[model samples]
Target: MSDAQNTESPASENPLSAWSGRTDGDAPEHLRWHQVVRVAEDAAHNDADRAGTALIGFASDEGVRRNHGRVGASAGPAALRGALSSLALLEGTGALVDAGDVAVRLGDDETPGDLEDGQAELGRHISGLLDEHRLVVVLGGGHETAYASYLGLAGSGRVGPNTRVGILNLDAHFDLREAPLPSSGTPFLQIARDEAAAGRTFSYAVVGVSEANNTRVLFDTARELGVRWMTDETCQTADVTNVRRFVRDFVQDVDVLYLTIDLDVLPASVAPGVSAPAGFGVPYEVIHACVSEATESGKLALADAVELNPGLDVDGRTAKAAARLIHTIVSRHRAG
Candidate 1:
């Protein structure tokens, strides 16, 4: 089915809102976290607060449908907002803002399906936020969000022919598909091509690749492109020292870092809501450590948690896991 067939409403309608949630507490005098947090227009970024974090949601799964995966990742943004609502504002949480979502535009016969267009819109917003000097934490519609996030990074005017931008992806698959159309599995390759065209180097590395999930061609693609990766077999608690070493080296090399986490990289026990759940995914604790180490490096320019399909979620574990990771990266970014 086409992407236009998946949604019940038109794409341009704003699917975001001023975030409101539970506020039950023992004493009114006690400090409550949400009071300080900003939402919708109030959360809109400005130069006055360079140390704040802004939230943007890419609420489209058209790429996933084109990739032939399960649907419903478009619901992820709302799920993330709900999951993060009641959490405490930890030290280094930073000033927060919600910029709402960039959703899919259901196409008619007169208009062609354009998921790329939505991605471009997201890129513009991401660029605007970065221009304002706010750290961006994007909520995803699918792993496809990576391409748009990449655009946002490039949009910042930070990249040039002699310069390089580092991309650190945590995923079970390389997502370097050579497809005629852009899909969730094709963002990285698209980024590579775009960088090459712009006379820039695409410095990419993946953590948590599953041999069972990726074909031999994908492996060759990774090798052919000189992409560095640590397999799922090596991303264990026992191997964390090496994992940290790999991440630290990657973090130190980039002028600006784009961190993308495809949630399917986590063990299925911890995240079963994704379109492609991993049978033997990397452990969450290990992923957390890698993310924490990277964020703490202070070079992480932007980050996103992708592929939480709430339609298949069991007990909300997957959304919770994604939210925890988001919290960790954003909090740590603030602390740094």
Candidate 2:
């Protein structure tokens, strides 16, 4: 049963698996990682000693959020994998594993149930993966994965002095919208409530969301809970020097920091493949600055780069940019 023998699952043997192969052959050539991304036949299970950092491209398009079709981001995982796999970070000493995409049923052109199915399935699968890896690089499927990623890591571990969780979300939407009963838009709300019921504390923060996109209701909820964040405009207007210092100072004693980047936070010019594009955003350089600064600060236990829609991408621009961000993170910590 172990992956050592390298046997394919019965699902892989099906003709449909081969029949419905990837049509995205046009990966970015300019980037180093895309050229080398392998279609991993085996879901990566690394030796604990060999485990450097793990990036699981969790692909799911179905979600009942506000704008599903407007942003074609389900293709995020595969596209990003192509970019990350090709990188030779720090002379190839980093151990990177492409935990294959988590499959979700994308509904017909218009259907709410299908999206919920995708969100639920993603939550279950990602929860299992968190048990294994120290660092998880999540390529967009949707913001739903953030709550899934958070809940997965939060569910098992009891918070001790060593246990800490900090959230940094970069997106135009607050994603704090009330769960419309039960759907993708409400994962974080549900997660926060669930964690509270379980006698746990989940401290979160968001970046990039503007007042117009995120209603005052969500802000009030977040503020009441003590979840602090820097808005997209704040991040954009501030000098990188001051922002880096702010980010470093903000996450000083954090044992686990979960970073969520919604592609919508990026300007449409640089990254057009976002479901929710914002007019203003922090320059990617500032994100790099904060991440690099954080590395020197303390333990960056968990991070997920979410929300890039390859189906909506122009010249593979966003994918490449996100890939470089991944490289910077890996290179920052990867052994040369």
Candidate 3:
């Protein structure tokens, strides 16, 4: 195993620090996320059948560097954890476990580790966690988190060639760049290729696409790959009935779902800390409604919130928005 696969202990260099929040009485009704959170290492001896949400961090933005975007998204996971720490834990959310992180190690020369290797390590860890938790939510480094999330679900043995796996990406870009190497812009393309190679059906849909941001060729590529998408303008102006129909149709077509949220999909005013902020993006209520639709379908197996660049955030707006979406996901999810 590579050094990245060696999960760090909270006592050591684990980024999951003391999750401090408001003090409520010892009763479960007053609990918040920080209060109920347990370290994966500490719970290693616990029952495997215990139902809970497993949170893993992918602390590498090498893909963003390769794609020539902002570089600070590597800190996304920690920022997300900090944002989630104080949130109220609703009843039925069940147990929440901190599974440390799958981080890109720095070499002696200070260069970042290989992105592909780190993704593989993340996949292995996520696959193992699936057996223990009902939901596995990966806090990400970039949109590259989607490919690694796919890897985990593919390796988990819960889905096979015959299973229809749906991928719902909420982002400003289609992320289908044909790059020689894997980058944040190339994860979905890589996933399509992998599905083709393995003879598995690829069911992918993207909401909140920006026509001004993506090239014509990218649209052509998405069309050629049979991708389903709705433009940002459509999402922004469409009525709730139309949006719900779109999401519900996609959710009904697949047996399992992997939902990925790229923070750039939201308006810049709401989420300015992403590598690419949206000038005209989907409204927060629209995004939240979509997330609720997916989770309530009982098909959501894995999910992630990516591209939260704390370095660019203004008063933690991006993290807070992402955390709210995550809160909605966890609260509504019906784990299978």
Candidate 4:
């Protein structure tokens, strides 16, 4: 299906149409009709107190495949917004803003500067949103923004030993491969490699890997970096708390953490709508459990839910699951 077909239908002619009313019931106003921002102005202005959390959604065409299949992942940001609207506001104490997608350049023979420029844009916007000390949740144009988020947050002089922020990732592929420069799939690797080069090493604990399917090179890289991992074998029988504890101890030096969730970690049975669905994966509860614990730990600076291409979803199952995960994340923060 086309990206347009996947997006939620426009507001209907119901009474709530004119105003941001709840025609669909009790869903929040911000979640409905959140326009896709192609520029920075729309993402820059926001009242810190009024906005509980700021999550800017956007995508990059790099690593995007044509077949018209997962390449439609560019539609992920919009698809997720449709699912997040009207969600149970959990504790009813927070606000989320859809700061539109970060404008990016796409196509073959794309210049490396394009990726750098996109990261620069993301860094500027994320820094602007962090002005309030509010947790910045970037909903992702792609996983590459993790580098920009770290660079911008670190550059602002806010990232330090107290935050004890570490990275918690759930992905099928380790994405540990690096290029002479960075690209969409190489963000985390660049983040760690670059930071360590700057004498600021980052600790990342990952879960839900598929050793059977991953390349030997990826495994070697993770091992070399001392990254703690919980592959498919472990995810099959481990409790969510186990993974959370790994994060709690690994990230003792920073004050806030950065969590990146790549939907490929889920088994095809659960997260079927992603760009790369694997066979055996963690249950959805694991995601919520991890989110709850991390937020309760008081060091979650930013959390990202990536790779949800609802255009390929069946019955909105995966989309709803992602929305619920974000809800619990917000709820946990409110509880603290």
Candidate 5:
């Protein structure tokens, strides 16, 4: 069923109360985990009394369909929620809110343009959350989520030409395809074009790019757009210190930061449930450390994780890995 008619899903139903797990009695009192998390029913009620982080899910696969990738990513949000529900909260557990999802639907009369509409809806929701001083963590349905994520940052009116927003995407592909339609592989290019049209800077840096995955045309496009990137060949544990320095330098150049992680950026052994699993992707330790460092830089305004296909996942490995990354970023944000 289309997301519009299936309003009973977590997106429209009780957003806050969608997913809840048992609180382990053995767990310490002050060390209570997300199982006992404080949830808000709506965005208005979220952090109304305080300023903190908010968790929002994006459950759509239209862009994956367009990209001819996997199809089960629509279920990614719920899987991530389940994995995160029982995890221990290391810090700043006071004002976390699960704002449900921006579920996409194709109207009976609506054309394939529903994809664009869905992204616009996501942008509006994210803009509202950012306006309220909430650090939003978006659980994504596809890499296409980046366009909406970018839109939210741009639409918030908080940024301007002089104050460029930094975008750090950790993924396997450059996702710079010039397709006739928008797909999972075109969000960053679209953002670059939009920035150029608006006369704003497009400060984008992608880590863990696979040389074999992206074509020469895509590489040219990245250069034309002035995108900074680190190839998977050099993203080893020994290189992590240099990687941290690179990330710190990037953070210094922009006023704000939006970090997006495509699960496919990890090795297939670590994340095999993505549309295109990596043969030699970056290690979780390296990625996590870099992300934590960036979050610690105090400029990580928002973040998201995408491309998790539960149908393809084995033993929920991808979901759990994605959840851990989210945990690190949120926890570090709280620390910062």
Candidate 6:
């Protein structure tokens, strides 16, 4: 990636200008994320320990368009940041660093940018950030963000042929589609193939799958690949004992974990602003429990929340939900 593509520089205007909220006080306890966040460039120059959360934005919807889904998820990063900015901060939440965005620029003729190149660029940035920050949270463009996230982990020098890495996806659909090219619906399968080529084990699990949404062939493919999953109906029970156990077992079995949240996993009534809202989705409490369980495991290295289409949002409800999940992932994350 070129230096021109990296917008995290301090000399540039603050990319987090969206991070504005009421100022309660100058003290740490009174501060919100906006008051505490610094640009990546600023963080690098400072003497403070780089032991906090680093946020990067993937501003591309090319994958979603290719998957024949709604096209507005490209704007998810800014919307998430806006939602997160005003949230109250706790004493030990650690420093927040905004690493700016890896954006897909449009051509003069208005054609879409290359999704493959954008994912590759995002991987390079994520790999670099993994070395400096305790936790790296990618604010996403679409489900394709997960594949780029996988690239970052593969290149971070932490995983090898023998290392067991787990991927936990929270979504209403199984994104294991067969396609001529990569798209929002094909990332997990791409990861599986990539892992196989590298002689690594592909440990993947999905929660909140909608049986009616995914075809039988997809289910057969998932089973053939040894993917573990729980349906939306299964996750809707008031008790989360099974959910906790499912996440706990996955976390225990892998040396490292990557958690990805697709907002469509939640009921459409709860999260209407997604490329494809769920007709029968997992409840918010169940999803929250899953995230909390994963982050508390100490093996979580990277996490992302994707598929928030601001154009379809109802009063920013989806953004708020996504932000809440992100907040939990960052605040509770323990580096492996």
Q: Which ten-residue region of model 3 has the weakest summed lDDT?
A: 7-16
Q: What is the lDDT of residue 131 in candidate 6?
A: 75
lDDT of 2: 0.58
lDDT of 5 by residue, 22-133 (tens): 6656555544345544443443454442366777788878788888886777788888988887777775645577667777652222355367877877787678777765
Query: What are the per-residue Cα lDDT tens digits for candidate 3 across 1-336?
Result: 124645332212444474677868679888889888887656545554247788888887788887889878878988998999989999889778877777765322245457787888888778877767778899988888888899999988667878898999999999999987788999999999999988987799998999999999999999999999988888864565677779999999998899999999999999999998899999998898888988999989899999999999999999999999998888777765
lDDT score for candidate 5 against the true structure: 0.80
As a TM-score, model 4 comes out at 0.80
Candidate 4 lDDT, 1-336, residue by residue in tens: 112112332111121111231344434444332221112233335553434776666565444432122555656666676676555454444555544556455555443325566666667666666665367776655566567676667655456543344788877767776655565567768777766866765677787778886689888888888778887666653566676675566555555677778777877888788776777787777766666767777667677787777767788877777877776776567422
Specify the poorest-scoring 10-residue window by lDDT in model 4: 9-18
lDDT of each: 0.81, 0.58, 0.84, 0.62, 0.80, 0.85
The alpha-carbon deviation from the true structure for residue 310 of candidate 5, after best TM-score superposition, in angstroms, is: 0.5
| Cα lDDT, model 1, residue 192 | 90
Question: In model 3, what is the error at residue 115, expressed in angstroms?
Answer: 0.4
Residue 195, candidate 5: Cα error in Å is: 1.1
How high is each candidate's TM-score? 0.89, 0.78, 0.93, 0.80, 0.91, 0.94
**Worst 10-residue stretch by lDDT in candidate 6?**
3-12
Best by lDDT: 6
Per-residue alpha-carbon lDDT of candidate 6 for residues 133-212, written as tens digits (9 for 90 to 100): 77789988899999999999888866777889999999988899999878899999999999999998889999999999
Deviation (Å) of 55 in candidate 5:
1.1
RMSD of 5: 3.2
lDDT of 2 by residue, 87-160 (tens): 55354324454545554555554554344444444444444455554455666677766765765466534234
